[model samples]
Target: MRFALFSDIHGNLTALRAVAAAIDRAGPLEAVVVAGDLVQGGPRPRETWEYLIEHGWTLLRGNEDEALGADRIIHGEYPPRFRAAAVAQITWTRKMLGGEVLQRLTGLRESFRVATPAGDLLVVHSSPRGTNDRRGGQHNSAREVVDGYAGTGAAVIAFGHFHSNFVRATAFGLLVNVASVGLPLDGQPIANFTLATATSDGWIIEQRQVPYDRGDELAAAARNEMPPWPASEATS
Candidate 1:
């Protein structure tokens, strides 16, 4: 069976649509899992949430989702510059999302697990420990990354939060960072995802980068006068 995994939509409906089209073109997929951060950066927060809900995609709550639901980011501290921008954008997103959408966002799960022939696949926004885990978003050291998998009990852990993509074999299991769909920070303005195909030997995973019109999203950001840092400079 083949499963398509993506995350960090961040309200870029264009990227979301492009990635979905690419997944459909790839043919039959057993399931589609969205690891989260569905809104609060790009232009269309409400639209992005509606589209995902309409499709009934499996969901995971990202930090942004939690912040949006709470109407404030809860981190103890963040770099001053980035924290200010994050607060502005998330506050805007919460107001833009209003009632029903915010409720739905609050209801999203923090993690999920699926049993595959190759192994138990655990999906989370950042790591198995949960969405609020700050260390899950960093690869500061190999030891730290490996330690994040403690008690997961899954051979494959698929996640997206750092906006970077990588697949690595660790002492715990195979860790797959599916990356971001809307705001990739890998110096590449492309939509990213991961396809996991269960084989007789094991689970074969493929990371995919689908090209979309970055200009459109950028223009929308410009027109809306969104924060110009972070996502815009991510590809630089």
Candidate 2:
């Protein structure tokens, strides 16, 4: 079986649509799953949410997605300094998403797991421990990454949050960072995702990058008075 995984859209509908087109072209995928961060950084929060729902993609909640709910103040989730901007953006995103969409966002799960012949595939926005775990990035050592999923029993783990992509194989299993679909901070300004095919030996995981125009997204940000897109930071 073949499936596609993507995450960190951050409300860029243009990037989301471009990635969807690419996925469609890839064809015959058994499933298309989103790791999270569906909204909370760009201009078209509602539209982005709607597109994902329309496609019926399996959804998981990221820190940004959780912030859109009624309990918007996520304590200890962000640095003390970035809290104000984070809260402001959350408020704006919730407004753009409106009450109904915000409620649906609140109901999203933190992770997802699927059993494949190769083994069980686990998907999370960050780490198995929690959605806000800081060790779920390329900045950490390989041992640290593998250690985070110690008891999950997932032979293949796929995730996205750091906006960068990498694949690692260890005794624990295969760890695939599918990367971001919209706000790609891995230097390449393009949409990113991962395609996993279950095989007899193991799963064949491939990282995909699709280019899309950002002019309209930037214009929407400006028109919506959204906060300036921050530089690549450790948080979220």
lDDT (Cα, tens digit) per residue for candidate 2, span 74-175: 646677787777778788787787788888897899888889898998999988987777776767886687668667888988888778889877678887
* Candidate 2 local lDDT, residue 161: 75
Weakest 10 consecutive residues, lDDT, candidate 2? 227-236
lDDT of 2 at 7: 92
RMSD, every candidate, angstroms: 2.2, 2.7
- Which runs in model 2 stand beyond 4 Å of their true positions? 70-81, 186-188, 229-236
Q: Mind giving the per-residue lDDT tens digits that candidate 1 earns over 26-51?
A: 89988999998898788778888889
Candidate 2's error at 147, in angstroms?
A: 3.7
Residue 175's lDDT within candidate 1 is: 84
lDDT of each: 0.81, 0.81
TM-scores, one per candidate:
0.91, 0.91
Error of 1 at 159 (Å): 0.5
Q: Over all chains combined, what TM-score does candidate 2 have?
A: 0.91
lDDT of 2: 0.81
